[model samples]
Target: MALDQLDGELEDQEESSEELYEQHSFKIDGGQEPLRIDKFLVARIEYATRNKVQKAIDAGRVLVNGKTTQSNYKIKPADEIIVYSHYEKRGERIEPQPLPLQIEYEDADLLIINKPAGLVVHPGSGNPDGTLVNGVAWYLQQQNPEISEETLPRFGLVHRIDKNTSGLMVMAKTDQAVTSLAKQFFNHTVYRRYIALVWGDPAEDEGTIIAHIGRHKRFRKLYDAYPEGEYGKDAITHYTVLERFGYVALIECRLETGRTHQIRVHMQHIGHPLFNDDFYGGDRIVKGTVYTKYKQFIENCFAICPRHALHAKSLGFLHPTSGQQMRFDSELPADMDQLIEKWRRYVKAKGDLIVESK
Candidate 1:
């Protein structure tokens, strides 16, 4: 996706930190007739038109068999077509609200925030206002009353984390910062590490999860990990076991690519859904004994952290103007911290019981 024009008007659309341009891939059927590449794509892609497809082709964002192609090029049987589209956003401005925000780091070009759980990043659907973006707008307005929405890129938000996932996030204060930071995120150069409490103990202490993640076929709101790359975008997560209880574990996950719900979906794919993650089937007791006491203990832990046990623990990237490395780290929020401590105590007491019984 091109970053040539950062000052252009943008819409109030929802996008992840890692998704700068929407990508679509198609494999031509064996019996399909030859058709112009632009026309071929327009028919298949939703809300796409000949002009948009041709513009994408002219920008060399369309690839056939991994190579750039002309808009009029005839599609062939069994040919692979990939298209990258960077759509400009335009709509009503986000209402600046005086919401409380935890500023971790700030400079002339960017701002780092320790986002708390239960705070929505961007307004959408049920969330019309009172989001992180709205807070940032208010903050920016406080800093410069005359600042216009067009001057700030994504309203200073370069990336986002889930509302339930607390931790560090960076926002670009200037257009140049947005351009540079967006490139870093798209290139996968930015560093992101998450702390997660998963339901089961992984076989390996450390490993990498390579899968294509996309929206679930049946559950449009939820994402699924496709190991065969059958659908969705490429996603990778490197994980290391931090602590182990018999039934669950604390793990650190480093993202190589940021797809929507990448860590949550990938962990679930490997058979270890995040503890208490209602969307991915972790809301119930996935591990441990089925005894009443054990079940009650697990329920207590769930009550400690009502949401999914995931936190964006750290973030790193290059400064937009200085070309210097800038990294930030955050502590686990109270809920997650308390949950881990409870697990620790539970494991230790169980160990003591075993020792005494023997």
Candidate 2:
């Protein structure tokens, strides 16, 4: 029933974009007590806060019984409700700049790009220029000489990969493209796989991590994973080992639910953080011995990657217009390949080094 509701709301909205993709519907049970709609919605919604619900209400994105409702409207039993949330394009104009872009695929509606490490996906805070969007905007402006930079649409990305995670990304070039891609993401049908070099080999060649991922209560920037699903949104990460180097392993990760930092947090929960992931304490020598040589070897490996050893290797989805499925694959980035090579040489030179218990 929720899936059906998702489809209806998506089709009805014309202001859809990558940032504004969340839509869900719910019905109050027969035994439910009357409560303010904003509070009720926040409790039922995943990753939602009170402020967000109130903001949505103010924006008239929340409907009760097919009419826009205020934050204080009391919900009753069997009452139908729909909540829509997404970041509206801001009024502030984004200045376009010409920058180098690696275009993997381009058509009338979208562009697929092979993003590199250390490049931020969108502009915010300290990074306001040299972003992928600015480059794309410039390219679009170049193609349409009649269209001025000021008239270019604000943004086009349907999803995002982390700044340090090099990989392929698709961005919409038209309003219809954005809506179709958003629906696929909301329904969890968009296929994406990642390659990661982590601190240790898994006992099984392949496995899955089903856990709830939410922001840490104490650490503002970190996430704490709950296996019992008591808190946070549901997240599942399936991984398979591709290679092992005594202290580290190359693995493939496929995501079933795309929560923020899902792979990094899930791997850390399982004692195998991504190699060189500075945020989750993987930057240290997590699985290697204390020998000086071993420490130096790991340090060199860190230098090679310099960031979390993660790459988005593949993407698949149904075409927005043609309704045909498309999948794209990419070779490992040079930095990750170099890091893997270093590990291979180290493991070969020194036989399997057992990792002792903490």
Candidate 3:
């Protein structure tokens, strides 16, 4: 089907007889005067962007005093306002192709899954199918027939994982759970830990990376720790080495402040970028005899693993309803295990001594 037709179908599925909008009337108080209807609506609704608000007004989706209004129409204090915003259809049709998922724990309120490397967490842009969100939606539908297209989680996504990374992720099942989890994430109260394989060993065994991260002005797709920009946000990540395998090191990172590509960018900032990350541009010994020896192995691994070597290994947070501490873990996926084992064997065969860590 065409993209526009598919979008229309999804939108129709999102509509419901149940009204989602709430009517409100604000009286002019003190010296306050009338404000633009679109501006007023923007202030009252969360997640409604300025452009979306404007579009809604232009499309006759907003009414002032029970009458349709223009985008620039002003609103008085006693004017009744009504908005017909059918909850945005945010769900995508991601076919569940029997993709391997390592489920750790599950309950009515939430689910924890050990996501494998190369799987897109949510669908967007180039990837619209075979996402974790699609799998979850399929699973939920299987478990409960009441989980209709309209009630599906368009906003229940409380947290996210990078496309190439593998590890544990917590998903909210209810809107209440979503709100509670979102608050916990915003407050930096949720405990998130990741295990990554980087290119070089760190000088220090453990240390904190405090840096301001923002978009690279030159490279929009990649992030950088810029000194100035409205974009940068404070990010803190603490990392410790679990074991060093000569050229590579397995490290555990704990996030104090979560930002886009926090662990990846911070690791790159410290001069130790992740292995096999083509975007960041790091050095790997894939040349001459070494390249020939591992070419087939690398090809096989890449065919199975399409993402970076990061994983959300552990997550801890407060349960929404019970208010009890909850934590979940996901073990390393099979492909990564195979890669590590192959590298280890190759190193040992080349007479490179392996260090035993107790």
**Best model per TM-score:** 1
Residues 105-223 of candidate 1 have per-residue lDDT tens digits of 99998899999999988766677799998999999989988765655644766677888989999988876676567667867899999999999878888999999987787776787
Find the 10 residues in a row with the least total lDDT in model 2: 2-11
How would you encode candidate 3's per-residue C-alpha lDDT over 120-209 as one tens digit per residue? 776666777778877777677677756643343342455677777788778777655654565577558889888877777677788998
Better of 2 and 3 by TM-score: 2
Two-way lDDT contest, 1 vs 2, winner = 1
lDDT per residue for candidate 2 within 1-358, as digits (tens), equals 1211222232123222223356778988999898998788777865566776776566455778878789889999999997654432333345678989999998887789999999987665567678887887778778775444222234555677778999999887764566567667766788989999999777878889999887776775677788999877788899988887777888899988777778899999999999999989899988857799878888888888899999999999998889889899999999999998887777767776533222
For model 3, the superposed segments whose C-alpha errors exceed 4 Å read 1-101, 148-152, 227-231, 283-306, 346-358
Ranked by lDDT from best down, the candidates are 1, 2, 3
Instruction: List per-prediction Cα lDDT, in the order shown.
Output: 0.80, 0.76, 0.65
* True-vs-predicted CA distance for residue 254, candidate 1, Å: 0.4
Q: How much is the lDDT of residue 34 in candidate 1?
A: 88
What is the number of backbone collisions in each predicted candidate, taken in the order shown? 4, 1, 4
The parts of candidate 2 lying over 4 Å away from their true place are 1-20, 24-85, 88-92, 145-154, 353-358
lDDT of 1 at 288: 72
